[model samples]
Target: MSVPELETLLVADREQVRWITLNRPDRLNAISPAMLDELESVLTASADDPSVRVLVITGAGRAFCAGADLSPGPGDPDALPDVDLARSDAVFELLERQPQPVVAAVNGMACAGGLELLLCCDVVLAAAGVPIGDMHANAGLLPGAGGTYRLPRRVGLNPAMWLLLTGRTAPAEDFLRWGLVHRVVAAGELTAAAEELAKLLSGKSPLGLRRMKELVRDGLAQDRRTGLAHALAVAQAHQKSADYAEGVRAFAARRTPRFTGR
Candidate 1:
């Protein structure tokens, strides 16, 4: 099924995967205030829709995103953007908090806010040689989303510091080594690669995936002992779930499990 027509994005659903493509190729997919609104709506819908088991984000043309629209608008010609920065940042946050897994297909350049956008995804796959960086420094701006927070956690502080401070775009391969990108593929294969990975995730137990995501994300903020305790609690609860029972029965029967997500 199609989503409401969007000016700045395109949507395609297949095999329980909802693919969202940034449609502003002419603008290098630079996110405007309007795009943020449309994107937030899509993200919310994807989260609530049971058919959407995996979400993939990519961009049209040669770039993933150039970041936020900093152009002058009717409200204030001098202001960077008339949009509410907090509201705009919340859109990215919504993506981060999605129940199902989110995959980022970085086809090309991803800078400034673009970098922050991808940081929220659960899995990231980039085109080989694709340029990526925190262009905020280059533009005399700062990331309003979770860029500063999530980037360091994924790539470690030293690498995050260099990228955030220098604003120098590097090939996606560098990020793969730094543990930010999960894989780097040829430019021509980016979408197919992302969808393949999404397909693998789509068949998993929904409740199990959701629980594990919440557990790991929440545990990142706790000490080792505390995190282990939290995991134990979660395990106890999960064992009582329908999916867990089905999994064990399937193993005994030597057949695939049918997860009901209960």
Candidate 2:
């Protein structure tokens, strides 16, 4: 599918993997009103496009995203429109609910809202030497985009508490150790590594990937018995899909399965 023109986002599709780059390099890709609007529209469109099997989000310049644009451009008539921070929650929600897996490629600094944005992704890969932190505390504010809930789940409660309470930045390696990041690579290899992972994901059964994502995400909030029941129900339903029959036939034939995502 052809990508729509967007002022704040650069969209590219390669082998069923859609890469969305935050394009305001001068502002470190900070979240502005226009950027948020464009992002939401693009994400919504990508979700509905069956051709897009996976998505990777990254920034253009020195940072993945510095955070929200809170500074008013005083005396500058060309300033961006006032950002409605509340809309950020909706954007994050849209990302979480997408059928395709979303990966965050943190090329550099990811703080406050930027870090929160990464937390919404299913997989997170960061470049070495990148500084990551929750800076909401430093600004006398709290995370408004599911950070409080997602952070604790990504890292342990203690680490999440320390990061959120202090708003101190740490190296990407620290996050990798803390289990917040899936991989840490050299800055020059960040995009390549993310694309490699996206390519691998794009080759999987689209229905299987979507169902597995749903099972894990939704099961996390359920009791053990309830989670098991849901998993069984999902498995049973998947057995009736064409992909499952193809998988079985391929196993019997000793060949790779060609999943049509039916």
Candidate 3:
């Protein structure tokens, strides 16, 4: 189930980080069916491996992702297109469900489904001057991927509605103001910034980070009492882990801990 190197998406692992790059710079890194399938398979592979602690997704060149590849329109132009929107969503869900942290380094124009993809990331870093638009409405369409749902949750109801309804393009400043992007950096500094953050996060106990992501994501849907209860349970469980004991010992000795991800 490994992805062929020539596909529109490319995945590589370094240290504990799995770097995923959109390779179709010629088409603005548009996602094709093979690309979508490869993305899912690669994500699953990373999730299953304990050595992977973080996943960084970015584009090859100018654009992060221009959206789906509607060019060939799913093999045949005459037949009804079997566009698998579900497959796209499965990728999104994989991002949400993955135990490791996922960071999206938005290099350039992230519009339509591209913006949706950004929303799926736990943290999004955008390059300066990069513009993002939700062009579904302008093209007489709507977000099929988790855009309508995740966009509102990230940016708020009013702003999300306006963007989706008007299909307006937002600059990097606007994205920062709307809280869509976690950080914004100069164009050339994009990779460095994201890598710095990734390095910092990767230094932590892997299980702690995974549980934190799970708690926040799953706890949001519960009542306050239930959420707190779940948090306590998670804390108790972690306290019993080997990494937690090492963390305490390292703290008392005033030294950095080498976490084995127990």
Model 2 local distance difference test score: 0.90
Residue pairs of candidate 1 with colliding backbone atoms:
none
Writing each residue's lDDT as its tens digit, candidate 1 over 1-262 gives: 4346799999889979999999999999999988998898898788878888899999999999998877787777686566566976789888888999999999889998889998998999999999999978886777788788888998999999999999898899999999989999988888789878998888788889999999988898899999999999999999999999998999999997877777
TM-score for candidate 2, residues paired by index: 0.94
Q: Candidate 3 lDDT, tens digit per residue, 34-88?
A: 8888787888888878888899999998899888765755457767444578888
Name the TM-score of candidate 1.
0.94
Q: Over 4 Å off in model 2, which ranges?
A: 1-4, 73-83
Error of 1 at 155 (Å): 1.0
lDDT of 3 at 84: 74
Candidate 3 similarity to native, TM-score: 0.94
Tens-digit lDDT string for candidate 2 (70-189) = 776778767854656679989988888888999999998999989989888999999998999998999788898889989999988999999999999999998999998999999889
Runs of candidate 3 exceeding 4 Å displacement = 1-6, 74-82
Clashes of each: 0, 0, 0
